[model samples]
Target: MANPAVMVLGATGRIGRLLQLCPPQGLHLRLQARRAQAGNSTGDWHIFDPRAEPAALARAAEGAAVLLCLAGPVPGRGGADADMADHVRLGEAAVRAGASAGARVLLASSAAVYGARGGLLAEDAALRPASAYGAAKAQMEARAAALGAELGVPVCSLRIGNIAGLDAALGGWRPGFTLDRFAGGRTPRRSYIGARTLAEVLAALLAAPVLPPVLNLAQPGAVEMGALLQAAGRPFAVRAAPAAAIPEVALDAARLQALLPAPLAAADPVQMAAEWALLEPEMAER
Candidate 1:
């Protein structure tokens, strides 16, 4: 088959959702839309919520060769405070669905899976998950890895970073994601990756020849806050905050590089900020 069929669980996310709508050359797409998103009549919308639409998902996975697990809470509406059953449910659902269809599962793990502290995390660094969210992801990874080992099925869990691009509260970051905030002149540093780059990474993960259930999927750069303001045609004192000092961690993406020719890994925050400032002219408005 020229295009490998893939089911995306979180097809409404910044990355997975975009791929379902505009799939690459080798992917024939199927998306898992939740109950509320049933009205989303875009793309090849499949009414499948990993948490509830298992039957629809099973059908969608039929004959598909890859499963991209990307669904998660958007902050508040999360799992029960007692257990991360929600995360476990999705992981289990995807594994079952993929095993039935003879497909590989690509799980969307997170950089947060590391912890809320600062450190340069390698692919195999010891996990020190801080938040309930991080702990849940750790549990999810265990499930994915076990499935991959026992079933001889490949599973890739990517620890993603601050996904940039639209949908982010900060839009049109032509001044850059952090820079746009600093344009107001005095903002904290942030980590970011272009949405397209993130989408590309997800696409590559499902197709990678070898599946590593745990991998870092972030651009290699620290988003400097001051640099961001400069790009917005505004000058502000910038500071490099310790990434590990923040909850949203920074990542080393050499692992992402070996996966595909997705060279956008170089779109570091510094480069992005500099390029933006160079390309766009400042308004004289004070």
Candidate 2:
């Protein structure tokens, strides 16, 4: 099949940039930025300020088949109320516009959205979002699913676990940081996927002609903090800080692997970790 025109709502985010670096198989990446985020640009562009109107979304998403949302500074994410509002508004608008455009929506979710889990987490795991950011993501997933079902559109919710790579560099996870502390050697146990790996997964999902209501996008194995840090070639503590509340997340890689060109990405914490650290920096930094 020919590539699809995909409009990424959070085109400027860490994940979005990675997607830009090596876009999925069928994506004509169109960026959706707020008026403020949109200063100077050339090429196909769509201006969207979730705070303003959902109508603007349709214009931005015109002729697009897939809608990928990576927008807004979510609540409890080191931002002001206005920032939080942007997140909520963005979700609603994207849902509405996605349905209107008859587009498949990919809602980027986090395992953190599942709240505190005693063991490995799955797609059906109960969501007890401990933080406001998790709550927002949970809401977004629910709304996306509901809206898709109610309409003819299909939505894919990737309940991701801790993500390594550049998102870590951007401090996307803090206060309740996942990969860092894990990589730091603190919070000894953690599970995560590298940024490029995540981009590849999202690409596969977007490529699927049909999407299930929800899916889990994470590695098959969960590694310890010490190993993660060592893999990344960073220095960290063996155990997490006293206040840290870590959840053991389980990601079913079978589906993710099925879409891959070959074998699944590395599952060993040390090796996979090293791939991102030793190999990534030396080879694939861009």
Candidate 1 global TM-score: 0.76
Give the TM-score of each candidate. 0.76, 0.80
**Candidate 2 global CA lDDT score:** 0.65
Off by over 4 Å in 2: 36-43, 74-88, 167-186, 238-240, 258-263, 270-286
Model 1 worst lDDT run, 10 consecutive residues: 277-286
lDDT of 1 by residue, 219-281 (tens): 776565444444534433334444434533567777667767646555455455443343223
The window of 10 residues in a row where model 2 has the poorest summed lDDT is 169-178
Query: Per-residue lDDT tens digits of candidate 2, residues 63-130?
Result: 78988888867444554654444555666677778887888787777766777666666677778988
C-alpha lDDT values of all predictions: 0.65, 0.65
lDDT score, candidate 2, position 63: 79
Best by TM-score: 2
- Positional deviation of 190 in candidate 2, in angstroms? 2.3
- Residue pairs in collision within model 2: 10-70, 121-250, 184-236, 185-237, 186-239, 187-240, 188-225
